[model samples]
Target: MKRLIPLILETLDRGLTRVNPLVAAALWHLRHPTRRGVLKACAALPLLFVLYVLVLIPFTPGIGDIRKAKIEQPARILSADGKLLAEFKPSNREWVKLKDISPNVVNALIATEDHRFYQHFGLDWRRTASAALHTFSGDRQGGSTITQQLARNLYPDEIGRAPTLTRKLKEAITAFKIEALYTKDEILETYLNTVPFLYNAYGIEMAARTYFDKSASELNVLESATLAGMLKGNSYYNPVLNPERALQRRNTVLAQMVKFGKLTPAAYQTLSKKPLRIDFERQTEPPGPAPHFAQQLRKWLAAWADRNDYNLYSDGLVVRTTIDSRLQTMATQAVILQGNQLQGIANAAWGSRAGCSNGKDLLATFLRETPDYRAAKDTGLSDDDALKRVSANRGLVQSVCESKTRVQADFLAMDPRNGQIRAWVGSRDFSQDPFDHVQQARRQPGSTFKPFVYAAAFEAGAKPSDTLLDQPVEIQLAGGEVWRPGDEDEPSERPITLRDGLAYSRNRITAQLMQTVGPNKVARLARAMGVRDSPLEAVPSLALGTSPVTLKEMVSAYGTIANLGGYVEPVMVTRIEDRNGEVLADFAPTPPQQELSADAA
Candidate 1:
């Protein structure tokens, strides 16, 4: 039995020598390799088990994988003229270098959380022993160093947050790997940049901006202390939501600085008494110009990212659009100005109950559709009672009236030469009303369709001087009903030339001409000229622009005419590149097609 015991101890020592030497030392004594040696081994069995998990089980690989860890960045949306339109960040963080971070914050963090940060390799043996003593006395204390915390922060699922011995050992192994791969300053830089803060913010840069409305470099001593204190618990020490607790935590951080000689005692005493005075503007990315255009482009870019196996939010893409910033500004301003005038005219007509179109109270109809009224009804209130309950609030009634009376407009401009979209204004204000009217709303072309009808006649070899009678016309319909067309203005009172007929917008003259060339001919020409998607009914009324088509299709048709009968799809995004300026994708206008003869166009 004695010979078997030594042999078994020799095998265990060889296995543990490759993982940890302390386990092998405690496992056996060569002079007395017996039952006594097994009793000594039990003292370090927990460590033996941890080492087994670390190397033998291979829960994770090595430092090579840790080097691949990266912080996510938002995509930059830029205009053609090099103007920053907006930013799209899902996590809402901005990365800043370690040099930009305040020294006060660094001092406070090191002194309070890990005083022996530079002295220890990763685990502070003195603090660990003291923590063990405290745990034995029923006073549990966390002895994790900054690097250890950073390990768990970088790989939460791998290292884990559970307060178990196995998780702690895994965290320690990762910390050692991190220490071997990076310098002390590099570790500090990553640790500060990665930690989370309150208000949907991550990293010191965003936290500084969120709490103090200042950049990370511009943080003062008090502001730095306040931010450093938040590392313990973000919302628990939030200056915006819980100021009293935040104040107490901030003073504690200041005391640590004084103890570590980073701050003078007199300064700490004076600073500690001061109230927590943060500017406290919850920082959010601005919804900049051409937000409507950028939103659609984002979807296309998202699809591209998915196909290429990249994350749109984290890959740090730069999208350069074809929209001119100056033209976009002018277009947005024009819509706002014209929309306000139209809104005023509409409000003046409907502001009073007497001036209503059908003498109906528009306010009552608007209020009945409100969620408040619906909720009141759902709670068993009658219609009349729900109306009274909702109407009691004057603000709600005024907002509803304003919303119903508002005038919405959309504008778009594209380059005729290459079909590049120069400017786009989707609405008067994207925030108040996000409904895009340019690509989505279908509006009647009205007199705009007159020119396309003239094109069809010219293609049939009809001259501009060719005359048609400018008078009312009657025809038989498929439903066996009489169809008569009237003129908006009094007909020229005689036969008029095709040019004069177009100039006067003579509805009857155009309708009569629709019969001469055939309705099918005009529709075939309309679709060829860019009215491709909307169904065009081949009727006499088609010449009068009775069919509704998308503004994009109409704009495309107009662009085709200007391009001398050549059609090209409008371009929005010109190119997208990765963070290192490497081109990921480039887009151009679609290939041109001759839809109409140059002479007819």
Candidate 2:
């Protein structure tokens, strides 16, 4: 700028030389001014520049509003073993506090970006002057301090990035406000958490994890230097993209550390020669092994966050669930192994003409149960047209006939003592079929309901060794209809023990037991043992498990027997914590209640 002062004096003499004789004569006289005039012009330039920058203070935003500026962070779901199940409403940033960050990262960043970070208020005048000198020689330098860079990052829209004098003025003013409002440590914390790195990574935390598969606190000196060096230009010094450039930049950062007294000269020499090794794996939100479970938990968590006044996507929360991944994986494997055989049997029964006795009728029934057929009917299509329309969609037809085409099952393992659900598999494929059969689908409990009837009878003073005649039972309804059960298997005409009746799933023996104990007693016992979600009809046919009940209810009911007649409601999430590792909520274990006598159970 000093070199341009004489040229500006000369330009005024040429452009206005022809315009006015007196102005050009005055300019010519000013061009050859005294040493005092030259010294005053040079002295007044910086003062004028300061006044011009001070005028931009009013235009600057409320940079001191640190009380409300929140960085959006994604919540995480983890299993009992601390394995990441999925990230809910995931983002590419993790806000790490200054304390959690390794000091090596701080030293590296200060050494490479701003050495006078602690000493400067907002700007380094000495470095700025040198940068100006370098710019004149065609070697540009970034004269903005860390505070200025952070001010730009915090309000990128307000402090525009275009290389204009006006933008720089606002940036400088905002940087001053930020420096006054926040501490040096706060600035560094926000700067490290806000800066962007390669691979959609933001913050030193994410950058460290993206390249090294570790948290910010776990970064070593060499790793910290490599990550800090990328702040110059993320893409240019990306370890995975350009290893040579990254290595060289890392060496420069190491040298800076040695110069700043953070690292010994001997250590720098040894560290600089080490190769850049990255664990670079693109991080994506995995559905985990419990997709259906996680999906259901997500809905519940949304409601929880709503009631608690927190944003599910932006507020960083760690939800610790009762789900054990080991048991979950084992249950998933069990379902796949067992469900395939059941599917084979179903396919062999329905896939061929000989297996399906009423193939046409069954296909018609399954087609009518589909939403596509109902949608076609709603659009004024007749039954034949709707059937034709549904059948035309091969994928839809296959899914509708998934009983034979796809094997779907639900498996839930719970710790009976505390009612903690350890594993939950709601379906074979949550992507293709999301219907959760565990608690959502209400189907007949089949012979599983017999245990409740037997328990009720046992509570009524009937022993397991007691014998009964295994014969078909009949009951006359109030509507004057005689009801007779059509048994799936023929019962032996001999007398059967109460234990054998339940072991063989003998409906006749169960019906006789129901008649002796009464239907109301059985329904009451079922509800008391955690089958309280739906109404259980007090009918005699309930002995055959005719009423529909969810798998969750049946499992809980069975768990009651295992718990020595004590019933406890199943628990899913054990606790929730905030981003700072503070316990926001802790869901204590639910106490168990006695439903029946231990001997009866």
Candidate 3:
């Protein structure tokens, strides 16, 4: 064993000599084992310490890029007039400067969180020592200063929340580094902006607006104390959820302020006695003007960002859309009014049918398709128990069905002159149904597609006064199949003018016109008019608008007719800007494509 030890030591000494000579020499001296050797090894300890310090110096964290520590800002979507349409804040925070926050808030925060905030470089040694002593004496407590907390908030993925000596050491180093990099006010500002408040609120600015319906600068002493108290543990002291505990914490902060000489004892007492007043209505995100259009713009922006290597969420972009706010509101109201009327008729017809009566069977069908029911079945719940469980959740199932079954509508209004989208209504409620029917969904246009067929007939040298038989017509397909087209009323052998056939949406007359012009030509004209995405087959049924097309495409096609002959591609976004107000890009309408002559259109 002694010989093996020498061999191991020799191998380590040789390896260490190539890496670190001081360490290798110490190891060699220890292996030799003499009184002089031991003395020499003791002498080399200071040199080893100096070498260690020198080695770590080059690898120290840099502090030049403080901007990298800034929290994410929400991107704003604006209308043509610069009115806010929607704001996409995934982090749900609004950054505010330290100077903007009330002095009362700053005082309350310093008193409660870190009394020696100004005196200490980064870590408060006196508080840390006291906290460590308390921990050793069995009352465990945290000794982190505001700087330490700020460091953790900025780099949570690195300095984690694990209660270990290693994590604490890293946190201390980061805190000291932060102090070296930024001023006290800067640290305070970053901390206030990064800290999480309860109810999904992050940062003092968001918390202030959420609870008080006022800006951080407008907060009074009591309000300031209330917000500061949440820094301890926001979930435990949430004003909305636990008012009593929040009140106690607020009083504690006020008391700390008195102790720190930031507030007088009489003022503290008076503030502590006041009741906590929070406006709950202000907590939720404000409803925007055009959500569907915003969502569609978000998708387009996302694709543009990917192609251009830009960030949509963090980079504070100002997206200027072509939406007219007044027109959008009117369009939304129209869709709601018309959709409700249609929904009432539909509900009266089908909502009270046999299987749908009382909605029990529908609820059961929905519940059976749920993951909870499947989990219950998988976990050995008997059929009877599963049924009981489903019965217990009948109200929830019913609510879900009602929400899903609400009548949806889509509307789009565009300027035929410039192809700028004036207004768009994608669905009844964007929260319930995010599906953009105008841009994303394809539905049968009914008789709305008749204009293209008539335009094709005119292009094929048929006049508006040209007459066609308004009778039932049967056409044979290539595969020996027959298609019989008819109008809503009884068949009439009377002739109708091409203009009247299109005006009344006459099916048989339009079918005869489609045959005269050729169905492929009609489809070609539809594409030229901006119905580009959905392919149209040259079938005889195309005359009666059997093919599915989006509302956006229909609007653009009709817009072409309204413009007399030229087709203009629809324009939504007008421009985009960066955080510093630099215009990144501007959008313009595509050059008009002539689909038909002026008289033909």
lDDT of 1 by residue, 17-41 (tens): 8889778666756535678677777
The number of the candidate with the highest lDDT is 2
Residue-level lDDT tens digits of model 2 in 1-601? 9889889988888899889999998887687788888899899999999898777777777743433343555678989999888788635777889999999999999998899999999888999889889988999888989989888876788778898879977887888888888889999999999888878787898888889999999999999999999989888998998999999999999999999999999998788889998899776444578988888898999999999998787778999999999898999888877887777787786765223322377777888887888899999999988888887876776666664356668898888898888999888766656789898989888788999999999998999999998777788877898777645777667899999989988878888888899999999999998898978999988887888998888888889899999998988899999988899889888778999889999
Q: In order, what lDDT does every prediction score?
A: 0.83, 0.85, 0.83
Report the alpha-carbon TM-score of model 2 versus the true structure.
0.55
Ordered by TM-score, highest first, the candidates read 1, 3, 2
Candidate 1 residues lying further than 4 Å off, grouped into runs, are: 1-91, 96-200, 208-282, 305-320, 352-360, 375-389, 440-446, 449-487, 490-502, 506-528, 531-549, 573-591
CA lDDT of 193 in candidate 3?
87
The residue pairs that clash in candidate 1, if any, are none
Task: Give the backbone clash total of model 3.
Answer: 0
Candidate that scores best on TM-score: 1
Sequence-dependent TM-score of model 1:
0.66
TM-scores of the models, in the given order? Answer: 0.66, 0.55, 0.65
All models, RMSD in angstroms: 8.7, 15.4, 7.3
> lDDT of candidate 2?
0.85
Worst 10 residues of 2 by lDDT: 351-360
